[model samples]
Target: MNNSIDTKRIVLAALFTAASFALSFIQIPIFPAAPWLMYDPSGIVCLLAALAFGPKLGAAVAILSWLPRVFLDPFGAPMGMLSTCCLIIPTAIIYAKSGNTRAGSIAGMVFGAALSIVAACALNLVVTPLYTAVTMEQVAGMILPILLPFNTLKMVINVVAGQVLLAPCMNVLHSSKA
Candidate 1:
């Protein structure tokens, strides 16, 4: 029985990783001002895994999902990974700590989204200048106008999507034990 459960977990983790990797290809330009900042639903899978399994597995899936992108977009991939982790880890931890209540889920998502936005902004200030043609001063200037809005919107979308899909995913994943 323990072996079966472990097998199920491994299978589910692989499924989540594959699904997230596939979903990363389907990007939508959410913010016109920053077309490079596309919205990908892969984070939804990470959230589901986090809520259903745990933060560690969620992070594992996030890393696996983002790994292929490292070759495709070296800088962007790391940024995406960081942002996704920032959004998911705190969420999973807080949700678990809150006794897994509905209110806890909501609070967790909110807090995670806020942290993701801040982290993205700070990362942009540092990393963007290193990779892109944008200077640190320019990146700082764009923070309020472009980065904040884009990151906020992206995080909001991820959080809302996670909320909408969590119960259904949990049901499918046999998340009663989660």
Candidate 2:
């Protein structure tokens, strides 16, 4: 029985990871000025795994999902992975600690979104210049106008999608427990 449960968890994680990786390819340009800053729903999938399982597993899924990009897209890989982790980890931890309730999910999403924005801004300030021709001053200047809004919008979308999908996911998870 224990082995079966573990197997189910592994399978679920693998599915979530693969789904996220596939979803990463479906990017939508959110900000017109920065078309390079595309949005993907992979984070939503990772957060769902976290909500259904636990933070560690969710994080594992997120890393696995983002691993492909790290090798294939060197320019934005580090920042992309870091930003996604910044969003998923905090939200997952909060949700897990709060007993995975609806309220906890909401709070976690809000907190995680805010944290992602800040982390993205700071990270871009430090790392953007390394990958692009942009200077530190340019990156700093763009943070408030571009980076902040972009990350906020992206996170909000993922949070809302996660919330909408939560009930169904919970149903499956609970049923699996039996």
Q: Which candidate ranks first by TM-score, i.e. highest?
A: 1
Backbone atom clashes (below 3 Å) for every candidate: 0, 0
Clash total of candidate 2: 0
| Candidate 1, pairs of clashing residues | none
Model 1 ranges with Cα > 4 A deviation:
1-5, 175-178
Candidate 2 lDDT, 23-136, residue by residue in tens: 999989998878989998888998898778777788888888888887788756667777777777888888878887889889998988888889888988888898789999
Which pairs clash in model 2? Answer: none
Looking at model 2, which ten-residue stretch has the lowest summed lDDT?
A: 1-10
Candidate 1 accuracy as lDDT: 0.89
Instruction: Report model 1's TM-score to 2 decimal places.
Output: 0.93
User: Per-residue lDDT of 12-113 in model 1, one digit per residue for the tens?
Assistant: 899999999999999999999989888899998998888877899999999999999999988889988998999899999999999887788899999989
**Candidate 1, 59: how far from true, in Å?**
0.3
